[model samples]
Target: MKKLKLIAVLVLFPLGLNLVGVWELQRSTDDHAEYAAYQADLAEFRPELQAIADNSGSRPVMVDVGDGEKMEVKMALSRVTEMQDELDTLLPLTNVMAWVAKGTITLGLLAALVGGLGLLALNWAGRRAMHSRDQLLHSFTRVTKLLPYVLVGHVVVMGAAIAAIVAFEALGAWHAGRLSAGEMKFMFFGMVLVAGCLYSIWQMGTQLRVMLNMFQPTPMDVMGEAVTVEQAPVLWAYVKDLALTLGALPPDHIVLGMAAGFYVTSGDIALAPANTTLTGRTLHVPLAYLGILDEAETTAVIGHELGHFAGADTEFSMRFVPIYHGIERSLVVIGQTLVDSEWLQRATLHPAFMLGAYFMESFDHAVMHWSRVRELEADAAGAQLAGNLAAASALVRISAIDPMLQERLVAHITQATRPTSEHVPVSDLPTTVLREIAALPLTLPEEEMATQLPHPSDTHPSNGERVASLKVSIDDAVRSGTRPLDATQACAAMDRYFAQPDVLRARLTDDYLSHHVQQDAVLVETLRTHAGNVTGDVALHEGARLRGQILIGFSGLLAVAGLILLLAPVLFPGAAGRDPQPFFVGAGIALFIMLCMLPFGVRLFRRAHKTALLLTPDHFVFANLKAPLPIRDIADFNLQVGNVVMLTILLEDNAPLPELTSRSFFAPDVALNKKKRWLMLPMSKFCRDDKKLKLPELAELIGNYVNAGAARHLLQQRSEQSGELKAG
Candidate 1:
């Protein structure tokens, strides 16, 4: 009982107290101490009057003490008093309000109360918060798994925001006929704080409203009986059952509400549409969330939300709310300060301010990307909760409905366009999965199988990436040892995970690579890890080459320019004439050029990766974007036959391959570009007599080098690794 009280107080009360503390901080900027001391000095002392002199000390007068010594002591006291008087005069300098003079005692009491409350509350909530944060850190392990990629993403976004700010400042500076970089970043960050604060408030309001609605699972009464099935149990009932099934000890509340799609509490999933109160929550998916999702996608609705529930995020959200609020408040204060800072009015004229703006924008992008990851995590949790059979069933059910009339009056739409839904049975899901437990299994434990989560400072991968992970986990499980998952169920799970568009977008990414490149090329796909399959060999040599190029190019460029800026002046002072400005300008230009080339450089690097493999007469030269790993160094590979053949590139060397593409999107450029383009004219002519162009060894090498490998040696290696009777 004591422990429980401590946990609750720690988790909940501190949050409330912090809200007050943060508000208090917002209200006062002046120095309270200086003002209090000032008031204390002024309370009784008169500036014009002198203290009465005491001549008699037990009749041993000033003469006995030595007249000069007595006078010096009195003068010293007078001087000390004058300094105090001066300090008191400057008391208002430290504070806007004369708090000490105007009821200082009362203010002190109030301050003490607030501070005491905040400290006490924090003591109570600290442990729970730490526990929840640790778990959150666990959830982000996926981010850590792709730490390089995530770090790159953060760099990209933050860099962009800084760039934008710099650009704006440059424009302003150009207009002003002057520029200063030093003061711009802070100035821009100030504006960002203001904007961030506004956004924070808006987001918090949305979050709060959403949470409130969480308690109300069913639709609003305004819709009356038409809102749900007649006499159907309220969504809360489902939440209760689902929580029970999940083995949630003490049973946390389960709620669902989003504009369009389903979502679990904390926006992480724990159930699959198990139960929810719609009253406070938004229902009737908005077009943004819906994005043409047919109305009948009940299982999809549940699966995505439940995935979030499975994240074990209840405690996370409870702790997160306060931190989020604090950050939001900070942003608001910062934004307001930036807007109000007269000093920044001049500072904003600097090109650096524009750069600062760019940095802020990048932060926004990071936040957005993290948000997308949250969505993906939710989707995975939802699928696990719903089960492969059920999730697929829900998708199939949605797919079968008529193309038209999805949002029409409920049953009317259901009656008008229900397709013959085709899907694997629910029983097909691996029985070992255990849909919802009261608590995760003690021996195996839920955390063991959990893909390592990310650290605190990671931008999330997309939903598709997360779902693919779930599939991969199940697949690996099947490969290592039978965990009882049927092929049909696995296939269905694969299909269902792919169905989310949030998972399928192939777009112009940071590398400037098109979606097709992202989808087809294992290298580019690895870089842009939003969605799609990794159906290629895990060729470390190729991945290493790509990563190396990207890292060296980006990291080295900045390092070099920064070093030159600080060194050129020292090395060539005679040429520089001791003017550091020129050197700094040169360094800045170099940095600018490198930053500008980031996307293009990244693309070329990835391009080089797929182009690295070569079937040499001696041995296959496994050169890739990162570097070449010759067949002599190759330890193994895996090959699979499907619509497109797949390979798993691996290395005999200690170095591991990038875990980006686990399969190959191997095909001719033209064939891949179009669905049905072929290589020859009409085939009616007699082939034996007709002369046809043939691929020479060089030509084959060119074609193979243009993309990932499907050459003879590579396949043989794969065969050998599989222990499938080594080909003669």
Candidate 2:
């Protein structure tokens, strides 16, 4: 059915293009004939007038005008010649139009033929696959292998055709002597086409370089800078043995880096010097994963990555990489080039270009679809090497652990910054955080997990789909008596392998801090001071209050305008003019606007009015709260910073509190159950200027009362640091 539909499209699309060409040619031809007749009439009329003027008795000729009126007029031969000259110049354009029309028809038909052949080939491949299960698999695999080449071919052909059409049009315009400098400059669109071709060539060149680079031996010094593998000989040996057991060439280099996943890159040993074998590769294991997964799970990850090498899937996949990138680059370049240039923008909006753009996008979607399939096939191969259960478990574990690790790392940073008597050694941080994360109940719910299906643009299958595939692979592996390696020992080996754990921890911590922290020391000091304050309700920032008032005032004006409009006609009859209908319509629209604005205006008024925080010596009262939150019951204070500063108040118990009618526009504070209590307060509501009272300060201030010991310790540390600076 799909094949038939494709065939129909191939047959009709080009024919439709040809029809447009035919219509344009006919119209231009008719217009040319009309202009030629008008020129002929003027030529004959001029001669007659000249003849009449030549005769002395016919000094003034009385010509019969249209509607049977006779008009006396003196004929000028020069004026007649001028009119004929204008038509003579326009006649060449008609010829050019006719030539363009013919070119279009020819190109359209040629495109149709090529499209038909391609569709027929696809149909043949599909039918051949359907003959048997083995043939079907072969056919599917072959299509995946050839699809990129086919798509690239299509792009080249289409791009050439478009360039030709544009070139022809430009030539026709130039021949007609109607091409302007500005029009000639639109030839930049052709340059854009050339640029796309160059980009594709560049992409292929880069791919070749990458492919060659993959085989070359990685320098020990470069590897040493980013990853540490010298300490974990056992883990390294195990991974090597696993590769050998899986019937794959072992990677020469195995390094632990900071990325959160594992992967293998293959190089051809044949390209290397005489001492090296033709199969050289590198395996990169993320330090983050090492701390999170157990030994068996880690082995499973290694197996999965090695599985790609075992099947040569990694090399095969690289073949399509250039093709994919080329298509993407071409689309971006062409679209942007056309859209950016004024003349080209109008020119490229032609049907041919529009159709070509659509085809390019469709081709991209198809390639991505195949890319996802390749990922699933790789997953299956990994399962075969690692055992289905182990592979699937590792896949699930990684997805769940990664996000939790990030959250815990941030918390760890927050905790470590406090001036504690017992300092947390930097070397122990990664291990400590990982252990804590492992203890948390962080599994994603089944329903939520199911929704992680692959998007159209995704290159890999969803976690859920991958797990399912692994489950099926697991049954086959079990029957084959595949014995999975012990995960515990692998994890222990990784832990032992890092020569300078402190360096790794410091790097990761510094990276996290750089991205997440954004406040100066003065702001922190201000927050500390505020944290110690046991004042009455803190008012909303003056700026925030004023902004809220502005919104309220605007909404109020809208409401007043609507009310006046609604009452206008009734208060003064015919004041809206004789058309009562238009008046009523206007009033109705006004009333609707009022209805929408009034509620929003009231909300803004309340937000501005109730902008103060009420705090007693023992408790803190949020905006318009009837009761205060006891300081002793507060667990901790932290900040989630973005455009707005959100102060998260962690409480020890889930005590019900009165709901504030006014909600923060930024993001409402979440109230979870008691014991795991956390409430968010947008600091923009209280402090307008970040320079005066930043998010970090608010966190510190709240932290002091919530956890006074930590706050006091931080303050002491700050004081000592300041004193040292002063002394220096």
Candidate 3:
């Protein structure tokens, strides 16, 4: 399906280019036909005029006026020769038009040919990558290398086609201008095409920059503390022995952290604690996981990580990871580019974006399959180190418990961040939390565990598939209860591995608490700001002010131009050559434009001067409306966040809303919709200083006010009912 879409885009772009050529040709053909008819009519009278002139020297010829009336017209033989010469010169213009049309059409055909051949080459490479399973690494490497060139080729071809079309169209327009005195109109269109071409170039440059940034060596965020060999000699020894047993290269750096899973990487890592970067191969041990898995299962997990370092997989990864990241980043940038572009720019850029996307998509598909295969091989290597049952058991335990553990951790953090929640003191907080999580019985159902697919990050296969490949039954591998290490054994292992386990755990806990404390502070601050906004005026975003200024300036320019156009021919009639029709037409257009634009500019200026949104105890007011909307009339308000943040206000049914025609710079973006009105402003745009504000925080604040209003209304109704009952 993806390939077909790609092909369709490729084919459609060239066809669209050809259509441009056809339109140009048709326009020129019409002009040529008109001229040809005029020239033929003139040719028929030439011989009679020549005969009259030769017989009578410089005689005035009698010509027919309208309705069979005769009129005398002066003529000379030299004047007749001059008129014929002018016609002779103009006749060759049609030939130039024909050549221009042919050239444009030829360019389109060439573009189509280039696009077709590029697709073929990519298809052929993809087939080789898919079928060459025996030489999988070689095949994947070849495809990876080929992909960049193919992508570049597609972009270049599309760019060249656009450039060519723009050139040919501009030439055609310039010629058309000679026939009709409308050069400015044609020039404006030409500028638009040129702008589109330039914007496409900018988009390509942005993608290239994103791709290039990937190659710059940057520290990978490990989000954990580093563990040196001196600090955890036993852990390091265990990893080295596991690597030796698997016949793989051992990691140079080790990190013990509270992340959900264990992993290994060849990239440089920046440890969360101590703010230090570690270079070369690194192995990360999730501290929480060690408490859950017994010694043998732990060994099996380590062995599996070592497997990635074995044979050709390590070499493949060294080459593949950078390309993978580059492609991912470029795709994200292009997608954002498309979103930010206007409709005309989108039309010009969509094809080029699609071609690049197709290449990335194809590469990802091939590499993902290869990754899955490599993971299976790693599982086999792990089984050799420990028994197949141990390997299978570790896989099942990790798959089932990791998700629940992550959820528990998030719940704990959420609890700690609440305003009213108090901190609990513990001697070793990290270890205590891990033990508690480990003691919780695994509730993951067998069916669900069997269905869990590989995470894209590591490409680890599902528990069911791994166990089946190892010839182990699901029942045998699944943990019956919390079969984790005893607390005493767990403490012993920690002591044996980490050098000062208690202090490290304490520091990690402090870091976690401190992070949550900052979050609580932010929440408090948002509440304070919301309280202020409820009582005070909320001003328009700076963008609104800028928009108002732009509108005013534009309107002023239009007015000046209109005045000039209207008075030009009137002030100097001789400039019009005694035919004032062109000047009249231009003045009429200018007058119409000024009439439309000036009023809109005034409205924007008035709105921009007023407050954008006014929040009060009882009512909400907008800049555009004279009357305020009572709080009771509003059902709800929400923040729709995307490329921009929009506050949508949903009104109660049949609520009285002011009728609006013109769009105000400071008013709601969509006021015509009866159900929902919105302020199309990003939160950041509201502040002069670049303060980062969250959507959910503002949403919550608004909800609080609305809910408070509802509570008051309910109490009032109850009081009224009580009074009525007493009276009865």
Each prediction's whole-model lDDT (CA): 0.34, 0.54, 0.63
Per-prediction TM-score to the true structure, in the order listed: 0.23, 0.44, 0.63
Stretches of candidate 2 off by over 4 Å are: 1-24, 41-82, 96-237, 252-259, 265-282, 288-298, 312-314, 317-407, 413-425, 434-492, 495-728
Q: Name the 10 consecutive residues with the lowest summed lDDT in model 2.
A: 215-224
Q: Taking the tens digit of each residue's C-alpha lDDT, what string does model 2 give over 1-728?
A: 54445544555666666676677667668877887888788877887866765673755666663488665545355556666776787777677767767766776677677666656655565556444434443544554455444433433344444444554444433323355777667655655665664455445443333222221223221121223246556666777788788876677666454423576554321211123333346666767677566566667777766765665454543333333343444445445555665553333232223333444443444445555566677667666665667667666666666666667665555444433445443444455565676456655544433444212123566766776777555333232222322344434544665555565566555554432333334557665775565443443331344555666677667767767776777887768776667766776786677677656555544454443444444566665444666665566777776766666677665546435544454322334334456666654444523124565666555554555434444566667864554454
Model 1 alpha-carbon drift over 4 Å, by segment: 1-234, 248-259, 265-312, 321-380, 389-467, 472-728
lDDT of 3 by residue, 387-432 (tens): 8888888887777777776776665564455422234444465577
Tell me the RMSD of model 2 versus the true structure: 14.3
lDDT of 1: 0.34
| Leading candidate by TM-score | 3
* Alpha carbon deviation, residue 540, candidate 1 (Å): 66
Q: Rate residue 288 of model 1 by lDDT.
A: 20
Model 2 TM-score, 2 decimals? 0.44
